[model samples]
Target: MADNDFVPLTPREGAALGDDVYAVLGEAILRGTLRPGDRLRDVELAARLGVSRTPVREALQRLERLGLVEVAANRYTRVTEAHPDAYAHTTEFMTYIAGDAAILGLARATSEQHTDLIEAVDALIARSERNDGMGILGGTTAFYQLLIRATGNHVFITIMREAGLALQRNLQGWTQPDEDVELRTTRYRRLRDAVVARDGRAAESILMEPEPSALALRGRPSLG
Candidate 1:
């Protein structure tokens, strides 16, 4: 999907439809329906959503803020391609949130959360050991997601939480898949073990940089 779809949902008339718009339209964009540099028609988008232009406009505004849209006064709105600046900005923002959560997660995560995290890590390791694609990778991804939640930061957790589909798309684009999932699975263990040890720095480091060797199995590069 186009990066436009990552717009966070905003409440509208007491109903949160932004995610629906962002998710559906974003999926279309990712699947190449609404591609980068494609002009967006507000009225057309509203009609598609069966809503007024306000929500469409709001969604576009959020997308613009996210660096996924470019809007000109009374002229046009369009999806924008990924740029280094955008990536650096967004990744920095995400990393900040993640770092805070890592610190807090190490301190505040409950014993149950730690146990759940360990189990998830074990699952990931098993997948890496098996070294399979589309199956173990899928499972390992789920486990990584659970680790994010164990951090106990609700907002960042929510943001990363909704990123499941998006992450799948990104992984498919940037990561390599192989017959053996076990090596990749061990990365999860590394992160979890750090968390289990209450070493926030170690956990965050594992997150900031994963095992390149295992990632190479997927044969994809980093995404913007």
Candidate 2:
């Protein structure tokens, strides 16, 4: 990495410091600031982030756990290639989990929460209309975040929070068919209306259906 490429961060102290570093570096990787096969040296990152090497190493360890980076003792630590299968698996995982979350959350959501979810789904529909890939990705994530939060399951919330970065990376470049955008937009509208009506089963069924993607969620081929 070039010296100019590394952005310095304000120094932080204590346990949360590690998390901040992890987020910074993880976001860098996701945004292609740190591309695949790029090497990471703790000392350099420590200096760049204005922290001790220990926290930099800790951050790297966390990234490695998420499959964003690969590490070898006394060898090298580098960003991993964006595996095609990861995208398929992530979508599959998200489809089912979001379906379940919808059922639980819609049952428990207040009127205010229902309004927020409807707004989020509206954003998704707008993004779909323009075929905005990244916008759709972000809007979908936000909509689901609200849905999951409504479920009031702490463990589920924590798990999804931990997996958020990996999910973003894996879902990058994932898109549905152009022809199906209108269909999906209709589905999203139905989904929004279902949530507004507090029809949990209808919302869940809409989300659980397979989208128009090469990587079909239903009966997807397993990796060897």
Candidate 3:
């Protein structure tokens, strides 16, 4: 795609400016608005976002570190193509980390935090009903993020931040078509109930259940 063809991002009102830019650009990439091999020009993005080139550059660098974008000095900066094995690897990592977080979170979470988790699960069901791919992605991320926060493990949080981005991108690529809204809601409801009951083992089991997409990734001949 041409440089001018990239979708423009609106300047966000709150939070750190760089973080907002990173989120907007990252979501665009995850949504496939910025496809693989599409070049990212900081000057154009800066102009489009009504920000200085600094944050755009910073965001681009952050994306590169996440393996979402490739930057070759003086040559180009482009969105990276999906790796065929990424889905399996990411799901494996998320299963363990998120499962552990669920156990710890159940142990650590306060009454308010339990309520927040239930609310997050409700939001996930709502997004699934609407078949909103991005919403589903964000809601799932938020649910796990809350759990990770409750664990108070900064190291795991950092790891999730890095791995979660790739997982979201891969999920966005494959999840929508086969997403069963009823099944998803049922699964999340079970998870929420477990967390609310402080049933750590049950919560872990629910979270670790093999996702359809992960199973497909293992069996499919090709991602294409």
Candidate 3 residues 1-224, lDDT tens each?
44554455555577677887888888888877888998888888887777889998988988998899999999999999988877656656666777888889878888888889879878876776676766766677687789898887778778777666677776544454465767776776777688778888898887767765221221122356
| Candidate closer to the true structure by TM-score (higher is better), 1 or 3 | 3
lDDT of 1 at 88: 33
Overall local distance difference test of candidate 2? 0.80
Residue 153 displacement (Å), model 2: 1.2
Best candidate, lDDT: 2
lDDT of 1 by residue, 1-224 (tens): 24444344444685667666766666665677778889998787766567667767777776676556789888889987666344334434444455566676667768887777667666656656655444554554554455567666688687775654434444434344333344455666776678679788886676566344332223434654
Off by over 4 Å in 2: 12-15, 126-134, 180-182, 211-224
The C-alpha RMSD of each candidate to the native structure, in angstroms, is 5.8, 3.7, 4.8
User: Candidate 2's residue-wise lDDT over 39-60, tens digit each?
Assistant: 9999889888888888898989
What does the lDDT read for residue 201 in candidate 3? 89
The lDDT for every candidate, in the order shown, is 0.60, 0.80, 0.74
In model 1, where is the ten-residue run with the lowest total lDDT?
A: 210-219
TM-score of 1: 0.68
Per-model TM-score versus the true fold? 0.68, 0.85, 0.70
